[model samples]
Every structure is written in C-alpha cells, then in structure tokens.
Target: MKYFACFLPIISPEKSQQFRPQHLEYLEKGRNEGKIFANGKFADGSGGLVIYIAESSDEVVELARQDPYVSSGARGYEIHEWEMVTKAVIPK
Candidate 1:
C-alpha cells in the first residue's frame, strides 16, 4: 500500500467542532488499524491533515469520506498520492 495525504479545509468550523468527538474516535480506530500515519490540524486552524496508507487515490477518497467532517458536510478535502523520498533524523 502507498501513502496518501488528505488535506481537509474546514468550511464550517463550528459545525465541524460539533462532530469532533466522533472524528477523533474514527481516527483512533484508524490508528489502531495501522492505517493512519499521522494527523493534525494546521496551527492557524485553517484545516487539518491526515496521512494514510491505501492502494489508490480512489481508495483514499473513500476512506476520507468516512471522516465526520466530510460526512457531515462541514469540510472539503483533496487527496494526493505521496512519495516519501527521504527522511530527516533529528539528533537528540
């Protein structure tokens, strides 16, 4: 499976907040399944991001559709296939 990044921009922040609990629950499930690589909202609160593993863009889109934000029509999103070329290691 390849990784895909889904960029979700909040269209209705208040509405999205109402479904936050459900959204977190869904994310936890995905994490436990090892399908979710990373997820977080932008520092400026503009939107959120999620990296997940999938075979194709369509599959990623379907998975994203399950998100409460999108399901509830409180956000809009775009999915892009990601290629990890290199990693940076921070010395502790």
Candidate 2:
C-alpha cells in the first residue's frame, strides 16, 4: 500500500518550532523502518509531504497521526493512496 501524506501547517512558525525536532525524529524512525519513501517541504514553505508504504490507507493515516506536528496541533494532514503504473529503476 502506498500513500501520499500532505501536511499543512496550522500554527505559527514560532509555535511549530517547538515540535520540529520531535517531528523530524518521528520521520527518521519511519524512514529507518522503510515506511517512509520520500518526504520534503514545499519550496514556498507552506507545508510538506511524505510518501508512505503500509498495508492500507487507514494504517498510513494512523501512523501519520503520531507525528509530533499532527499530535501537537501544529499541522493538519491528508492521506491518499497511490497507484504506480510504471516506475524507472536505476542500475545498481
């Protein structure tokens, strides 16, 4: 199951500052666990997105709910499933 998680900031930058570290730590854990495939903030800094792989969209949402940004009310997120019809692979 692949999902796209789009996170929009809900609080001021100053308030969000307090949760950044924990949020990044949570992402790190997800990355290490292979649940997070890709993640980045928008160029305009409006928000960020994370690509997740899980059993279902519900599972992805549940995992995203644990993010400090979401848990602390600093950001709101939406999760959508992704279907890859084709992908390009780099040679090893």
Candidate 3:
C-alpha cells in the first residue's frame, strides 16, 4: 500500500456547506475502513487536505470522486502520492 495526500479546494462555499454533513459521514466511513490515514482543514479555511493509504492512485481517485463535496461540485480535489523516506518520533 502507498500513501497519497489529497488537497481539496472549496469552489462553491454554499454548496460545500450544504453537502458537509454527508461529506463528514463518508469521511468517518473511510476512516473506519482504514482508507483514510489523517485529514483536516486549513486554518485559513481556503480548503482542506486528506492523507490516505491505498493500493493505487486509481483507488485514491475513486475515493475522492465519491466524496459528496467533490461530487456535488462544492470542491475540487488534487491528489498526490507521498514518499516517506524517514521519520523521527519525540516523546511528549
């Protein structure tokens, strides 16, 4: 499995607001299914981003397509594959 990051731009705020409830529901389902690794919105509210792990880009794209926000034309999403070379963890 590979990890991909999806950036979503809210094109139609009104439409996005309308679809947000369903969108959140789908996100919860995706998270439960382990398709979503992590996700959040920008502090500025311009858009949002989601990190997902999937078998292929096609799968990621399909997931994005099914998002109500995107399907309803409330947002546009761009997907990018990520390559994590190294990581370090710090104890709090």
Candidate 4:
C-alpha cells in the first residue's frame, strides 16, 4: 500500500458545519476499512488534510473525490502521493 495526502481548500463556515459530521463519519468508515491513516483540519481554517493508504494513486484520488466535502461542494480537493520516514510507515 502507498500513502496519499488529500487537501481541501477553505470551505464556507456554513458548509463546514453542515458537512463536518458526515465528513467525520466518512473518515471513520475508511478507518474501519483500513483505508485511512490520519486526518486533521488546519489550525488557520484554511482547509483539511486527510491521509489515505491504497495500492495506487488513482485509488486514493477516487477516494478523495468521494469525500463529503468534495461531493457536496463544501470543498474541492487535491491529492498527492505521500511518504513518511521511520516507523510511521508500515513495511511494504
């Protein structure tokens, strides 16, 4: 599996509050399925970052596109392959 980082730009406060619950539920679903690694909102509220694990970048992108934030127009997303040093990464 490989890691991916999905970035979402600042969303309107109404949208953020409207979608936050479903968004977090989606993350929990991914976590249960072992597809999610980590996630967080920016301190400055610029956006959110979600980390995913998948076999290919395309898979990660597809997953990112499905996020409630993106699907509901609460946000748009950009995804890139990611790599972490040391023990944070599982052995391939």
Candidate 5:
C-alpha cells in the first residue's frame, strides 16, 4: 500500500462548519479501519489534511470522496500522492 496526503480546501465556511462533526466522525472511522495513517488540520484553520494508506491513488480518491465534508459540499479538496524518501528519528 502507498500513502497519500489529502488537503481539503474550505469552499463554504457555513456548510463546512455544519458538517464538521460528521466529517470528524468519518475520519475517526477511517482511523479505526487502519486506512488513515495520520491526520490533522492546518494551524490557520483553512482546511484539513489526512494521510491515508491505500492500494492506489484511485482508492485514495474514492475514500476522500466519501468524506462528509466533500459529499455535503462543505469543502473542496486536493490529493497529493507522496513518496517518503527519507526519515529521521527524533526524541519525543
């Protein structure tokens, strides 16, 4: 499986706020299903970001389309497929 990081761009602030809870719920479910490796939102509160491990970009796109935020027209998003080239371990 490959990992893809999706960035949501808020389109309708009011609709986004209205569906925020459902959107979170969807993410929580994805987390439990082991589809989401890690996720978070930007500090500026513009939108959301999530990293998902899936078989292919198509799968990632499909998963993202299911998000309540998108389905409800609360927000728009962009998916960026990533290749983790290097990693450095840091003490917590």
Candidate 6:
C-alpha cells in the first residue's frame, strides 16, 4: 500500500457540521480497517486532510468519494500520492 493525501476544502461549514457525525464515523471505520493513517481539519478552518493507505490514486479517489463530507456535498476533494521522507515527532 501507498500513501495518498486527500485535500478536502470546506464548501459549506454548516453542511460540514451537519454531516460531521457521519464523517467521523466513516473515519473511525477506515481507521479500524487500516485504510486511513490519519485525518483532521485545518486550524484555520479552510479545509481538512486525510492520509489514506491504498494501492493507487484511483483507489484512494474511490474511497474518498464515500466520505460523508464529500458525498453530502459539504466539501470538495483532490487526491495526490504522498511520499513520506520524514516524520514529525510529538513531544510529551
């Protein structure tokens, strides 16, 4: 599997909030299935990011399309392959 970064720009903050529950559930499922590496929204509130583990861009795109935020039209998305040459350390 490879990493794909999904850029999700908020189209409607209201809609995003409306569907946030389902979207969180979807992310949780993906996490349990090992399809998602990490996901969160931008602090600036412009958008969100999801790192997915998949075979190809096409595969990731298909998976992303199922996100409640995308399916409910609360957000728009683009998929790109990500190369992780480094990791950030989170200090305790």
- Total colliding residue pairs, candidate 5: 0
Runs of candidate 2 with Cα error greater than 4 angstroms are 90-92
- State the weakest 10-residue window (summed lDDT) of model 1: 83-92
- List candidate 3 segments past 4 Å from native: 85-92
Model 1: number of backbone collisions = 0
lDDT of 4 by residue, 5-91 (tens): 889896576787799899999999998899998889999888989989999988987898788888888887888888867755563
Instruction: List, residue by residue over 1-92, the lDDT tens digit for candidate 6.
Output: 89999999999999999999999999999999989999999999999999999988898988999999999999999888999776787323
CA-only RMSD, every prediction? 2.9, 2.3, 2.8, 2.5, 2.7, 2.7
* Per-residue lDDT of model 5, residues 1-92, tens digit only: 89898998899999998998998999999989989887888889898899998999999999999999989888887998888665777223
Q: Record all residue pairs in model 6 with backbone atoms less than 3 Å apart, i.e. clashing.
A: none
Q: In model 1, what is the error at residue 27, expressed in angstroms?
A: 0.7
Model 4 stretches astray by more than 4 angstroms = 87-92
TM-score of each: 0.90, 0.83, 0.90, 0.88, 0.89, 0.92
- Candidate 2 lDDT, 1-92, residue by residue in tens: 56565555556676468898998999899989988877888888787888887888778888888988887888888777777455788223
Model 3 pairs in collision? none
Candidate 1: C-alpha lDDT: 0.89
Candidate 6 segments exceeding 4 Å error: 87-92
lDDT of each: 0.89, 0.78, 0.91, 0.86, 0.88, 0.93
The stretch of ten residues in a row with the least summed lDDT in candidate 2 is 83-92
